[model samples]
Target: MRINVLQHTPNEGPGAIQSWSHDRHHEMYIYHPYQFGNLPTADETDMLIILGGPMSPNDDLPWIKQERVLIQQLLDHHKPIFGACFGGQQIAKTLGYQIGKAPHKEVGWAPVYRQTDAIPGIPEQVIALHWHEEMFAIPDQAQLLFSSDLVKNQGFLLGDNVIGLQFHFEPLADNVREMAVNDNTYPLDHNDLHQTPAEIIAHGVPAENKQVMYTLLDYIANH
Candidate 1:
């Protein structure tokens, strides 16, 4: 299967998603719309994975608008999509939902509770890394899948093929460190929900975290 990842930045790559693709023996392609502005067609992409970024979906940038158009096309064709952070917000925006600032900026590792058993392999509560100040609203027809203390709409499942997660389950230790170093705008000023840079990189990616990401990919691939 061709798993195409729409990467928004250089630092935030596919991370554990690349490992999962390699383990599954699927071809993985990463496109940098922020750089070359290249994107794959829905017909050629078997599965689309949207990575996290510092940019907002509300940005009036050309590539951002173009990415949303591609997402809409994929949705129209019933193609599978898995998005994290800003990518999740893109999916919500394409579906006509509003995107805005979260109640509080959730950074570093945090606990997100499973809201439903529709998608198996997700625990009742799992600790996942988050680094977003913006949030996606749950669409009317989408199922609320996860929620955190700071953000109520942490995740949502739209149809059987599309899944959006507001947290990072795919970032490894190095991925987290790079993101923390490159982005210094995390709202960690006396915020209880926000973790410091030192604390964020201290704990490496858990085995269970990678497994959960793999489970999500497998579910999206097979379903």
Candidate 2:
């Protein structure tokens, strides 16, 4: 499978998704819009994976708009899209959802209440890494797949081709460290729901938890 990853920062790489791609021996092409000005053309992309970033999708920048155009084209083609955090906001914007600033920043590991309508492999509740301050409204075409007590919209499924997650299931402990190094978000108790870096790492990345992430990616690979 040919996958195109839209990365906005040097710190945020594909992480576990890269591992999954390597494990499957799938072809991956990444485009960094933050560094170079060009976003990848979705022509040969079987699936598009939008990674997390610190930038807001609502930013009025040429590159951001350019990315949106690509997103629209991919949506029209019914190509699969898996987006996290900022990527999720971009997906929601392209889908006509209002992206708003979250009252509190959710930075740490948190549990999401899985909806009964969730796809296979997503348990009733799962603790996933989160780091974001923006929330997107659920598009009418999409169904809410997961919700947390703090954030109502955690994940949504819009057709089999598109899925958006507000948290980072792609990041593990090492990935978290990388992000921490890039951003001065340490001292950990950034907010009430925020956990310290040590706490998050202590929990570690569970194999089963990552398998659930792979399950979602598998859907895009096969379906």
Candidate 3:
């Protein structure tokens, strides 16, 4: 199947997901709104994967508003979607869910406690990359799937096809390192969810997370 990745920034590319698509021989197209002018129609894409960025979903940027509309359109059609961090918040906001600052930002590697009964395909707990200051209320039509100590609303499922994750399941060791080097706006020292670069590197390799991501992709592919 063809997958279209909506990349918000140059640094935050579609890490492991891109590799998975390539290995599966799936057609993967990237649409970087920061570089591209507009989003494509639903007919032009089979699935949508929205990546993370430094920007918030509530940002007043014109492209953000346009992307929200496109997200809503994909939802209206029941098209499969997988979003991370800010992308997740955008999906929540477009679905009439509330988006706001969390008590604190979750940075580095953290374990997300899965409400397994809520989502059949996911595990009980998964070590995911966290790098967001904002959180969202689970949409009324969606089912809560996961939660973390720092962020309660870690993930939600809209219908059987669409999924939003506050944590980054697609993080590679390089991605975590890039985040550590570039993200200075959010102070991570006092945050309970913060982790050291060594800790993140120890577990953030593609081999460690590939099965988990593949399971998610399989769920999306089947649903």
Candidate 4:
């Protein structure tokens, strides 16, 4: 199957998802809209994975609007989609949810409390890489899957095909470092959800989130 990933920046890539695809021998492609904005037709790819980034959904960029229209097209065609962090917020925005400034910025390895599951592989609680300041509300008819102290809508499942996760369960240690490097404006002054750089750098483990990511990918691919 062809898995196309939409990347907003050079730093953040498909991390563990890319590893999963390689393990399964699935063909993968990446589209960097921040550099050159263009999208593939529905027939080109079997599934889409929207990756994390420093950008917010509220930004009024031409590329964002174009991506929104493309998202609608994918939804209309009943294509499967997996969105992470900023990508997740974009999906909620496409579904008519109000996405804007979050109350707090969650960076580093944070604990996410799972409320429910559409896929059985996800545990009751998982620590994922969190790096975003924008939050999203669950769209109508979507099942709420997870939540954290900083963000209420951590994850949501829509129409058996689309899934959005506000946290980064797929980022590897190298991916995390790259993400940290790109993001210069860390809100350290705010007491809300700000962790020091040393703490984030210390928690390094690529193997931690790989299996769960593989399980989720298997579920997404088969179902």
**TM-score for each prediction?**
0.96, 0.93, 0.91, 0.93
What lDDT tens digits, residue by residue, belong to model 2 across residues 96-124?
A: 88999876678777788887454776778
Q: Candidate 3's residue-wise lDDT over 119-158, tens digit each?
A: 4556677777787788989998788888998778998888
How does residue 113 of candidate 1 score in lDDT? 94
lDDT of 1 at 221: 84
Residue-pair clash count for candidate 3:
0
Query: How much does candidate 4 score in TM-score?
Result: 0.93
Cα RMSD to the true fold for all candidates: 1.3, 1.7, 2.0, 1.6
Q: Write down the worst ten-residue block by lDDT for model 1.
A: 184-193
Please count the clashing residue pairs in each candidate, in the order shown: 0, 0, 0, 0
Cα-based lDDT for every prediction = 0.88, 0.82, 0.80, 0.81
- Cα deviation at 77, candidate 3, in Å, is 1.4
- Give lDDT: candidate 1, residue 184: 54
